[model samples]
Target: MSSTAEPAPAADPPSAPAPAPGRPSAPGFGQDRLWTVDEHLADILAAVHPLDPIELQLPDAQGCLLVEDVTVPAALPPFDNSSMDGYAVRTADVAGATEEFPAVLTVVGDVAAGSGSLPEVGPGTTARIMTGAPLPPGAEAVVPVEWTDGGTGGGAATAMSPAGPGDRGAGGEVRIHRPVEARAHVRARGSDVRAGDLALAAGTVLGPPQIGLLAAIGRGRVRVRPRPRVVVISTGSELVQPGEPLGAGQIYDSNSFALTAAARDAGAIAYRVGAVTDDADTLRSTIEDQLIRADLIVTTGGVSVGAYDVVKEALSSVGDEDEAGAGIDFRKLAMQPGRPQGFGSIGPEHIPLLALPGNPVSCYVSFELFVRPAIRALMGLKDIHRPVVRATLAADRTLSSPAGRRQFLRGAYDAEAGTVTPVGGAGSHLVAALAHADALIVVPEESSEVGPGTEVEVVLIG
Candidate 1:
């Protein structure tokens, strides 16, 4: 009778789990925050600022974007030069010259490259000139060595003899077998670029050819966004060095090496901190040591919810201990193989840090999706992402993925066939498969399965 009277008691609502350190807890129950790929990319980009411009040598500035319009300081070539190693002559003298009845001219002298002495070509006279040699005065055109009778009245020759060509006897008298127009085989002063002309605009990427142009304009150094000094570290107690003998349950440390190389490929000056054991104080100390040298910091293996995730434990408190805004915010992204990520700034300098997953393949995928773009952005590059192409799936069977996760599978892309074939199964531990892959096949969050012949977006790594 008493139990029946007390049967109408009220119950309380279930509570949501508390958020992790440095992460803002969701407001409601059963609601976990999940970031889209674009959301995560935007957050990363917002944290990065382009490096300050510095004057670097031409070779050092290669692959870096120019921060200012590089005007031609001096006219390219600086003076008119001969484009061929032959005779510099007036067009009028060789107007009707031919092999049968060639125009004979007296050799005034030879003009080699970098020759300071000048030679005057009077009427009925020519100057034997080398390629890149400044054109002698009073010469209106040039006759290539091949067009003449080798200056020896013999058969055709492949090249003109180099150095003191005047001593070769052929330089004494040259037969003008072919007529040349005005300025023929002669590069005019500033023909390539004139003084005050814009040789390269601001934001131009300096490659081999661009560097050559700058050198031609007499620019030994240029102002450009400097390459980011990235520091990469790995943390795992069960990880062993590659050459060391492994104990039971030990795996070789690969994230450090892979991430360092990837950072370099992204145009950052990467410094490998190797692997640290599962110790929060050690990780904290190591990061402190690297703060002075790092423009960006990358850590692998410690941003998860596990009890022993030292990176999360160490860096979560950095904001409070050091200066303001010095902590990392760990995120759970709606993506496969690289869902757990941590990004933030640390120390007095507020250096950006990206903490990725522990799995070898997962780390690499994270690097391509986030680290690469961050590095390029730091170098003031306009295009940060890898080239994406639409390709047809080339699998024999349909490929399945997690329903709500955006999956990135390793693939071998056939550029000619315009198809992409998955390299391995959906396993994050397959390092070998990732190595064999040259592309990443992206499956959308809403698409759980993709069949052969289906069009997909592929990120070309090659």
Candidate 2:
């Protein structure tokens, strides 16, 4: 639970080698050597640290983690209050009262909620109390309006008459028809929370119920770790904005929008920069311009070894002059769909950056594996990884995966049946299949083929 705001320096993965000057290192660049998914994730997580704490109003602090334990200032209820709108009477007066013969008492003035003064209930008197109104002095129990005549002198009254000038039972006699016990129907002081009690512990996320509790404990503002500001950039030459007419060899840009939304879902304040064409200088300048507001930078498209990979070409040399170990490391991972990946720090502040592949499915998978956890770590969340469960593979035939490489296939999981069915073919560009998938079926690198009915690990992403 350290509150230090400064991020810890990123360490190079054991499998990754140092980059050559003016270019990022791609370990085993021309060979078969590659980093595992776990290795790449560890490096990214090692570099991220929780953001600094800041004081924010209750409404603005929703979903933020509390930086310190908050204690209750006063007892919840603060005083004895009524839980029903009925007569507040002494138990002795209402004891053994029934429909055959009821205990009659004169009603005093109404005791509405927030009333400063309270009327005393003596041996033969009762006070009409509203729900949440403080229990008046000398009143031992409350009779719900449904259990009494409600001052109408009628049998089995349903509700208490109004207390204004047109009301007939404001100061009239009320007949109690039920026996009562002391303190019944009364919310005792400190019943919910007592003074000085820990209302919320440190590292608690402030949701609606937690916010209500904080407000009940009189906490108008609290200290919490602010969400990280994430800047999402997509780079490609043939990318066009959605809603615009597509020219030949051009496709709509979706990576930046998807990643931006995904970042927000991970509890980061995300900004989506429009797609930057395949130009090294433009991409580099765009990333530089966004550094002012970015705590983490995520770029889709251009980490592959292709000639048109502008992201790799532009960011390979970034932050190299600022400090040693300050540039991105582009490398291949021993995984399907998302193989080409890059991670490192950039800018004077050394903000963390993740470079993902260009394919739609590859880009999103990389985000879930790397960027999502980074954002959660920055937000000070304890459980940063997605939930994983074991499920039987629901397929008609055996599935194949490349030897020595782990494969993650989009899937539709049925929790009730404890089975997962693959959504579509294992193509990195299958955005339609990715959209329908609620889970990722994990095929281990050691297993080249998996048969139907085999139990496999599934990562729940829905």
Candidate 3:
């Protein structure tokens, strides 16, 4: 009997030396693969702590995380107000008034909103009131304003008295063609919310609707989670910032912009720190400055062992001694594209640093697979990851992955049918491939060969 229950499906086959036939390897690609996805993820997560304190103004605080609960200082609609523009009459006067034998009352003083007088509707009198106005004293029902007339045509039939015709001054009354019910058309005070009720709990992410709600409850300001400050630096001597003159062999620096946008979309304030050449000293100095003012630091390129690669060396310098120069941990994971992902602390400040490989596609993939979720959690986003689904492959292709590492292939997800299909050729440097992909197919480490009909899990990217 096998002890491991079906051999637990190998994550991927170990990379054989001289590499598997027909598969191309980057120059000097080693036979030994370093970190596993789970291993590196654990290390990365261990280095990060929740973000620090922040206070945002209420109007500008929509979509901001709440650091404290917001309770209603007072009941909604603080006082009993009318819900309709109608006549406010004493219930006693309209008790027996019906269409056949209507009760007639005199109309009294009109109560528009913001009026402070406490006008009372006596027995045979009524008061004209507007919606949202406080219910006049002794008012029982509000017959819509459209239902009442001047009453001059019927010889005082519209002119009625208050208190069922008891005292003087005509006292303003309402003619009721329909029988009255207790409290009908009258909105009771605090009916929507009790005084001092808890409107929202701590850690709540405020939305426009929630902001409106808070405003309704009289809260002009609210204490909310501070947005993390992220500095995105794209490193490459051959790159130029967008809108700048492109020298020979120079490509537009897009990683920094894309990553910055991604960070902002995750609810963080991001700054692009410009590009750095492959020089180790320059990279180190740039990161140090960013670290002092930044809560999160992300750098693209040079994480691999290529001669032009200095990100790995710079990161290694930042890792704890046995003291590397800095205190960062740099290693290649057993995955494609993002294989050379680096995570660790930098300088004396202990700033968390994530060094993604230079390949645009690689950088984006690593961020989506790892950093995005972490950022969302810190920023208190409701849905941490893009929705994923299981589906069958639409086409078949053979790709080699380390037996111990899982592979994430760019693809598209058909949500209605719950199927995922690869969007383009599996090329790590193909940025266009990523553009067309809507999701990522998670091919297991043991999946040496997957046919079109094979059931697989996909991580929705779009």
Candidate 4:
């Protein structure tokens, strides 16, 4: 049997190849007419490219890829400042000081942060300095208030009392109970970063820390690959919005909400459109209207051969005649539960679109296997696929799969135990099972049965 484990999907510069000759076609597909999962994924990735980088405010650029290296315009801290609210005095003045026989110094004035003017500290004198306050001239070190008498002329004081409205007199005395070394409790200039240093490199993903660093370096705006705007549409006449009253044979539209949330989780700015009815004209017009704001379009349902398959009928000839890379290709895949699929570019801009099956589990699995990677790729990320691991199958009975088809079964992966147990049966409509599953158990095309304790390739979803 051929290896079922496939490498992580990457963008390849080739269209999907046709089915091999003399190969038995899966049921409902014409003889030797089916595409492999890798082929479909490659085609989708190859067609989609990263969005152009744009300058955005720091807040808006969070989670985006930096397109250029950000350099520090000025050194961090800007100047030598106090790291503590304490007395800024010459190091020699505090030397040999002790609690029993402390060194007394005159408190000339207070030095607060952002103070334009300063008090110069001469020998036998010190200044009361707040945290982050610049060291006054002639001061070589800072002695924390805890190590001094806080100018109260008592035992070692715990804190400095604020001067009242009428108590603004700077004529006080402070007793230094301990000796402080040079630069003690003082932040040296450029200690964190130097001017012209590369703060962040290109291709770096900007997280909270990175954003903070950019702001620290005075970068109010930055250049980054913007998040792709994905428009998700679920098509079906029988589908109704959630929280609305349900009529006969009408089911709540979960695919749009699910796929929209999935797109966001994949680092996209996703918009969930109201479900479209089973009319080719409405579907086509809806897609055309969304093109103005969409970087990628995803639709669920109506890609199969059913007579009422609106997606296939609507998008079959969607490309403009003048457009080069347009038109959708509806094809069956050699996979279980998600055989019917459609992918191609449409509209004047030729935005890429993916049409998935209607079944809840199938639609969701197809999204993880295809849409997530596409979104990451559009964000200029190199690693676009979910993590995978090899695990032993933990099933009571042997698992059965269809030959010549790759089946992805939802499973509960016990990472600590390194075992994965299948969730629910092999039904594509099992949303409850999919909800409880954190991984997918892969069954290769050539293998129809998998016994317990056999190792299998598991895709970690959660």
TM-score of each: 0.88, 0.90, 0.78, 0.89
lDDT of each: 0.81, 0.83, 0.69, 0.83
Between candidates 3 and 4, the TM-score winner: 4
lDDT of 4 by residue, 243-356 (tens): 999999888898899999999989899999998988888888888889999999999988765667778778865546356546677766788778777777787787888888
Candidate 4 global CA lDDT score: 0.83
CA RMSD, predictions in order: 7.9, 6.5, 9.1, 6.1
Clash pairs, model 1 backbone: none
Residue-by-residue lDDT tens digits, candidate 1, 164-262: 544523345778788899999999998888889999999898899999998888889999998899999999888888999999978888889999999
Ranking by TM-score: 2, 4, 1, 3
Backbone clashes in model 2, listed as residue pairs: none
Worst 10 residues of 4 by lDDT: 1-10
**Ranked candidates, highest lDDT first:** 4, 2, 1, 3
Candidate 2: residue 165 lDDT (0-100): 45
Best by TM-score: 2
Per-residue C-alpha lDDT of model 2 across residues 1-462, encoded as one tens digit per residue: 000021111233444353344322332342234778887787777778899999999999998999999999899989999999888999999889998999989987678787777888899999988899999999998899887776745445444543664342346788878988999999999999999999999999999999999998889999999989999998887889899999997888988888989999999899999988888888888998998999999998877666677777788666543564577877777888787788888877888898888788888888998989999999999999999999999999999998777789999999999999999898887889999999999999899999999999999999
Superposition TM-score, candidate 1 onto the true structure: 0.88
Q: What is the lDDT for 338 in model 3?
A: 74
Candidate 4 Cα deviation (angstroms), residue 431: 1.2
Report the number of backbone clashes for model 3. 39
